[model samples]
Target chain A: MRDASETEKAVRLYAGTVYGIALSHTGSKADADDVFQETFLAFHSSAKVFHDDEHIKAWLIRTAVNMSRRAVCGKHRRAEELDENMPGGRFEFAADEQNDIADAIRALPEKYRAVIWLHYFEDMPVKDIAKALGARESTIRSQLMRGRERLKELLGKDWFEDE
Target chain B: MNKIFEDMKTQAMPDESTVNALIESLPEKPRKRGIRFSHIAAAAAAALSMLTITAGAVSDWTFSFLGDFSSAFGEKTEAYNIVESASYSNSASDMTFELVGVSADVNIFRVMLDIYPPEGTEFTEENKPCMNDNITFDFYLLNAHKGYGASGRFDVLSDTPQKMRVMWTYSCSAGIEDREIEFVAKKMTRTKDENAVNTDGNSIITDNEGSVIKTEEIWYTRIKTGSAPQKVKYEPGGQAIDLDRLPDSDERCRIFVTSAEIGSMSVKLNGLIRGDLVWRDSTFTAVKTDGTPVGLIFSGGSTIGGEPSSGLKDGDIILLFDDIVDPADIASVTINGTELVFK
Candidate 1:
């Protein structure tokens, strides 16, 4: 088991990314909590030693992805109707367009949502995302391209750049 | 998009209290000095609760229901009764396997096997089966009397240098008796890690996926399944809902909350009109009397195949809540805005 200080530091650093990945995949706060708890518990109990913080982060991200997949594929897996009208977060956005964009991101297919969040939100490169997801970089690129297109379509032509 | 992403990142996370509670719940780290006193105490408590048979030779084994890395078995194995035991050693593979125990139910069958590597064998990061994906087990079940045989999916519950615990489960056919059963364990092959590649100076290997894969035979053994537990019905209280009277709804159905257990809950939705009925995504919430939301442990659904416009259809939906709830504490259940009081 990890020391209390170490666990606290790691949790504080990666909690957002982990929870975001869970929420992106699950689309439900309750499911995300289960993923978050399981991921951390696994980390605490893991016997593998990390070489550095990047390795730790990568392992946690990968574990989070795997756990989210298991949760989605679980026997009790259910489709929870997402409330598109609900606020994305506790705080109000400065611009209403931001909320629209957030909702659009959430509305994307599960496969696309994780790649988009990691790439655009987490600022992780395609290679890292590929390594984290145990997939080829080509797959990540394809997902990013397709996810961007879907997001643009949902937000309308005026909302996205033509690149 | 970047601005939106940034704004979203600023959203709230689980508070510190939750994190602290999780850290506290974690099992104590294994002591560097062989075995600690606390380890024995905790193991004794766990063994007592699990009702596990502690043989003289295997007195050191610690059984846990939490399914942590230190424990040889999971909590689910506690429900099973040990019916058979065998010991086999493979010189070629430098391993010894003991068919420590077995358990079964009507719908599922479980086997617990302890694997021991030869002395001086170091279970390092490079050789650990779980981390390296180096080992695999092929399991088979047979009933010669009835001439019924099939393979089952095997899973490694926990692994350690001292011993590795493996469990497998498959659908149990009717009329299959424990006395007539024969379990077969085929030798496993240790495959080379295909992902391990030389990266030169770069931290990441670009073409690692193209690496060659190779395998060599390792350990193998089989043992009979001992006993099976009686099938128990897990029926939770039921609640009735009139689908026609649901808020903001055109469809009509009668739904009942069937069972609620740790990590999962089930509901039976029946008597649907079934015309153009799309089983689209729906949300269900279990709330306390004060309307505080109870966390859902798991979320999944199974579709009951039925003809459209059949005038009557039904489906069983099971939602896994995060924790068990007291029936009395539950005020109501809301599915897609349709609220129904507990029966």
Candidate 2:
């Protein structure tokens, strides 16, 4: 099992992944910071035992996803009113595509957005996404189909076909 | 299919030094994060340290563990060292809880408590008389690292009984462990609400208008009880979960987790809901606030709720009691000797 130092290192290593997930879901630096802090805090508070490093990281992602979902739904985390003092991490998406992707993802609703994040950003297989998200494989497959369909609808079918 | 999505994940990683800097910024010793009674451990340490500091006592700093965690890309989720916290009393007069110190490796920390009243009482915020006549259990965090803090306070009756407990999660380079501590508050309150108990041994008294009167007043008291410091195992690679356990929709839904061992765990969800929330594999689905389908995401990190789907709108209702989610799904509950049946 990873020790405290190792845990810190691991957390540090995954900071980008965590932030990426946060930014995609929240679309704001402030919300991402809260999600980052909250995800680590949840990891700090949880007591489940893990047999290996994979288990620990899974827990962290799970905690971050859960925290992100809460942030999205919570009134206190509105992106328009983020705290000025929040930790700053440069988001380097191309200016034009950034807004397009953000608006499209935001418009897809939370469920679809969650699936798309796991599939695109996290790059999990449909099966893995189902497990990580606490869903059935068949259901996840369906959601993936619909989420891609929605994205195409928002960004145009050519967007997906082109990429 | 989105190359931008793939590219961002690879490019967004923070450098190792940045992570170390963030970790280094943590108080070496345990310090309060904010001034909420919910922050009992760090606040207690802060209160105690202040006493030593004010009395010119040598710095007898103490560090309590909280928890540790890590995550990976595209993996199943996990919780390393979750625990049930105990209750404690915060009777400090002046409290400060926050980060104090940090070393290259160790995050040394401490919390101080200088008790003056029982938990759940508010003292004179201004120079006026201490109204409410209740015991005040104030907890705080004192950061020696930078000089920032937070606090949690409780105002209880002057004569109410009080206790303090601690549940901590310890993290090492390897894994985590759980520790528990319980301490009785130095000051105890014997004050009882005279209106709460009737001479006839009943907790309620009725008037003649066929209206119900609540004779007993429940005090909004906060106790300082949490687990001891324990460490969690960290992993760079992520884990996996079952897809069948995910909520089917995204709308306001109620989750019910039943256990023959611990009775049940439930939560009314307004946002995203997961199915693989508990230790045992169980049912996970999402419905609207009115118990209809909105969306569902499986344990695999996939989702299924949205507009014309199973998502929720504003003004939806969500409620949770004793981990029992979806109050409507529960047929009945017993609180303070009163049986409540949900329609």
Candidate 3:
């Protein structure tokens, strides 16, 4: 891990961003905390040779993403078992409806929303996203199309119409 | 949808407390694992530091150029005017290193800290630590008794400020120059059988107190000023010993590989294979062949005092010990096609 001062600096630089990534993925405060801590620890342990801010930020994001995904999958498995035997229990969303957007994004297959986030939120073009996600630009374009289409369906016509 | 996305943009930020809490919840600091800088420097600089050190007391000392001289393709070597005293620590560990009286080249990629020990000591005949990009400490020990000698390599070095506290109890009576003791060292690298159940009478691997000798490998390189230095390669014909066959127990096995011509040596264990091998402390230990833990006895050296023994976990495989390694070797450590081989 990094020294306390450097770790503190990293926390200041991207903890929020890391936590945002975790919260968006896991949708649970507790799980998000675990992911945030893990991502920072991973970042601290590595990233010493990180060339600059952009590289450090990307390393954090990648770590946060991986840890959050693992947490989500683990939670999903546990929830599946819990709900497996239960009867007539009401299924509830863990986060607010606004965060359902993230849920919808998570629902898409792995590479799909990766491209979408890079394109929409990260404002990265298809070529760069393609390189980052290890996919062809054409494939990223298609995945983006499919992801947006799926998002539209998940949000329903009301969201778009209201917009 | 646009409004929903915008709302997320506002709420997506992780709270300050969460970040603070996470950072706070982490240990106050990273523990210094394996090989303290004092351990390497004190071996050579022990008497010197204790002696009356004057500014520019000794000049024009020659260091062993064991390893290769020619820089490989795409290798960038950054020369730093090695200072006599610098507070350096591994960015990831709590261990700190300070140097006394030396100058050398530093490559950020390999992070190599070539130590040139003081002149006129023992074991100085061409016994150099291999070159490694992993810069841990920059100290040198020149052997006076052996006419001309250099200090062994230390794996950790950085410009960042760091220090490690050591408590040493010296047991050797042979003075600093001629002490030839076979230090019983536990092999840092282990195989499945080493940690597995042993059924045979000749079981070398066991969890019993004295059955297995565990050890860790630290790579070092020697640098010499003026003209070309030497090159040392632990690979390309280096021997790999399997520790599991020798009967399980805590037994110390000391294997001294001559790194006299090492430019750099790449160190790898089965566990530290996937990523950078961060030392718990800068110390290596040996066990009794019968499974007894033998404390590392520091003799013919200064007593900085010891704190605790540190080491890497059993599952960590050091993938890239130096900045440079063959692609095939890198691929060898990949766990299930993943770049990092944690097992």
Recovered fraction of real interface contacts per model: 0.26, 0.24, 0.20
Model 3: what TM-score for its first chain? 0.71
Q: Write the per-residue lDDT of candidate 3 for residues B175-264, one digit (tens) a residue.
A: 121111111211122233345332222112111223231223211121222111222222321223233322221212111111222211
- How far in Å is the alpha carbon of B105 misplaced in model 2? 53
| RMSD vs true structure, all candidates | 22.6, 23.6, 22.5
Error of 2 at A152 (Å): 1.0
User: Which parts of model 2 are misplaced by more than 4 Å?
Assistant: A1-3, A75-92, A158-163, B14-18, B26-343
* Candidate 1: RMSD to truth: 22.6
Write the residue-wise lDDT of candidate 2 on A1-163 in tens digits. Answer: 2244655765765687676667666676666677776566545544456656656665666556555655554533233654534555334455567567766876675556667766777766878765455444786788777878888888884343323
User: Ten consecutive residues with minimal summed lDDT in candidate 2 chain B?
Assistant: B67-76
lDDT for model 3, on a 0 to 1 scale? Answer: 0.36
For candidate 3 chain B, the 10 contiguous residues with the lowest summed lDDT are B301-310
List residue ranges in candidate 3 displaced over 4 A: A79-97, A125-139, A157-163, B1-3, B28-343
- Candidate 1 docking category? incorrect
DockQ of each: 0.11, 0.10, 0.09
lDDT of 3 at A115: 58
The lDDT values for all models are 0.42, 0.36, 0.36
Candidate 3 to truth, TM: 0.35
Query: TM-score for model 2?
Result: 0.37
